[model samples]
Target: MATSRALAQAPPAPARRGQHPGIALTVIAATQLMVVLDITIVNIALPHIQQALNFNTTDLSWVINAYTLTFGGLLLLGGRTGDILGRRRVFIAGVLVFALASLLAGVAQSSAWLLAARSLQGLGGAIASPTALALIATNFREGPERNRAFGVFSAVAGAGGAIGLLLGGMLTSWLSWRWVFFVNVPIGIAIALLAPLYINESERHPGRFDLVGAFTATVGMVSLVFGFIRAAEHGWTDSVTLLSFSLAVVLLAAFVLNERRAPQPITPLHLLRDRNRSGAYGLMLCVAAAMFSIFFFVTLFVQDILGFSPLRAGFAFLPISVAIIAAAQFAARNQVRYGPKPFLVTGSLLVLGGVVWAAQTGITTTYVGGVLGPTLLFGLGMGSIFVPVMLTAVSHVAPHETGAATGMLNTTQQVGGSLGLSILVTVYGTASRNEARQQLGAFLHQATPQQLVEFRATGRLPAPYSSQVLVHGISSAFQMGLVFAALAVLIAVFVIKVRPAPAPVSPSGEGA
Candidate 1:
């Protein structure tokens, strides 16, 4: 019950005169859009990047994973760095790093070069994003104005990925895949230039650095993700896959033990002590994981199977962004009145229904018949969860631990995405390979000399046959998404508890 009260309302932050609050909010939203969009901007570019870099099917996922892994891994460290140094300084410096990384990624000459640049870009994002949130308090007074600011920020952050898909399409279609990275360069520079002028610097909060905990936790999760991806390409029994899993287990166990004793753990174990908060975390992880299916696999399907051009495929996703923005605003207004359970349950059901519909995607399915309904449902469901779950995470957090708590919320969301993607990708790879094998048997019946030679060299069927294999894999991946949505619903209904906000007191001090 006490945990539920933190969402009651934040006290008004000290009002500072002379700062351009509007400009500050723009800079914040722009910076977040840059950071979050990078996670999915590459979605539409994957086919292009894969062809240009000569990446195998499994390795192609790394372009996205490389960025997210480091971004999620280093978030707490980045948040604390802002606390120790000045937020404005850290924020500006982060923007510079991000800009430079984007430039590097844009001009990458090799797969290795691109992946490295992507990881650096993630580092820059980690440094910038959480500190950007802290800067909001520096720029705006807490109350209705601040809540409105957050609502705007959330709309930008939540819809950023869908925006990226559209943006990536235009860039990849007209100029080059490189433009996706280059687009961020200008945005990052503009934000860096504006942040100092418009945003005030928060006073340095002295804090102990849990570098060891952050390192272990980050590396351990990477290993777990690596193992999943590895097993997808190689068999689960493969030596490298076995080694990766073993290493992950040992390192993650070490991370937990280190956190238990660390002076100030990057992720305070006590934060998970509350059922409401923990349930939010658990549900967020599952929902984030399931959400990836729409962007990654479905993006592939529309382009590779449905014959949608990159630009058209991008615009196809525009409705999802609209649905989420609308639903999220609606939920943000009503969550306190009805409590979180109704939204969480209803949203998860939408998500479940969406995934089930999407799993039926086949070579014969059209976008209108297959993609729109599922993506819209999934987007609306995601909107429902975004506000309530976030409010729940910070509800009972101690003021001193607030930074750590929010950092974990972002970290969980990011890492959960990568982890979930790795799992779905594994399923995708397995099912695609099996489908490929099945197609090979039939293909020999009609194999021309050129087709036979190509099949021998690349081990892939052409055209319609290839599309069949891809659709099968995507269908299987969405089937896995079903489990994620189900878990989210179960967690919300059974585990999370939020009593509606206590009645506001009147002028005489009695409940209104």
Candidate 2:
């Protein structure tokens, strides 16, 4: 009882007085941008990395999967760690670790070395990302200040993937692919140094870490993600794939049971009881699934079908980043007055439209006609969805559980992206093989004897037929992405019901 009393009497965090809060926010937002961009920054550099490290096509994917699996799997544990330890301390440590991993990755000589470094980078990201969000809750009061801060954070989250593509292109073209990793070193060091002088630490809670919950949840997610990735490469009926799925189910079930009883649960079961919050999670999951698949498939389409250079392909996404940032700012300003539901419903519909439009792309489609319009629509819709969804996810939550809530949000996004991409890849592979056979058969029937002889000698389809087959496969995958986006709209409209509260007034007698 005395311990409980002491805990209840813990002092609130120190407030910023003379210091400009903007400096602190910039540091936090920069860190978030770094963490989010790392997920995609390595994508454009993959072909180069594979060549340099002598990675086979089959094993090259591990460079990405290694990072995603560890990051998504360990996020809950990382969040809870911040709740027990101070967020600022953990945040700094994470940045230091991330910088070191980036250095190692830049200098890596072999496939094994790079994969190890990427996995370590994922660990650092898991530690830093949630703590970064939790820090906003700690540093800013629950008013316009917090809203504005979240606005910047949300914009960064939405735009980071596109920005990464551009940055990756520049680095890979002008310098080397290694610069993508090397670039992070300076940014991480700057953030770490500035953070101590600007950001205040949150109050720590005394609690036992739930080792059982952490282990089960992390392993479960890893298993699930591995199963999806393997199913894309091998048939779904493969024994190893079946085994991975089974282990995921068993371990995830164990995690749920453990969470229900743990003294200090990594994911508090009570948080899921809120209808709006649960709905937000579902909505974000579906939206992210489509969004990530768009980036993956569209990148391939432009590079392979349109025959774009990496630099040109990267510049193609610049409009998306700009659109998202602009829309996010607008949503952030107007959401308090109009509420989140309108934005959620409208934004999701736009996403549905965008993906559906993209599904019609063909071998002869022009960049301006086929890609630019759909991407702009997607960017606008995604930006609107992010701000409201983020606000609703943590609404009415207790201060201490802020980290856990935000961590869950980020996990849903990463896991959903992995699952969605795997599903799309499966669809693409099946469709491409089928289309190739059909095209080949049709060509054989129409080809001259000399053409047939050349085809037989080369053992490959002609350029036009090959491009058509590839485009057909890509279009089919976009159709699937369309379904995902439509589902997100339906979920947002029916499930989410949170209305925004009126803007808070500041101490200066003005609306914040």
lDDT of each: 0.83, 0.87
- Clash number for candidate 2: 0
Point out the worst 10-residue segment of candidate 2 by lDDT. Answer: 4-13
Model 1 regions more than 4 Å off: 1-20, 50-59, 137-143, 445-458, 506-512
Tens-place lDDT per residue, model 1, 255-290, is: 899989987677889999999999988998899899
Error of 1 at 5 (Å): 33
Work out how many backbone clashes candidate 1 has: 0
Per-residue lDDT of 450 in model 1: 91
TM-score for each model:
0.90, 0.94
For each of the candidates, give the backbone clash count.
0, 0
Say which candidate scores most in TM-score.
Answer: 2
Candidate 2: lDDT of 479?
90
Give the top-scoring candidate (lDDT).
2
Local accuracy of candidate 2 as per-residue lDDT tens digits, 206-242 = 7767889888988998888788778767878989999
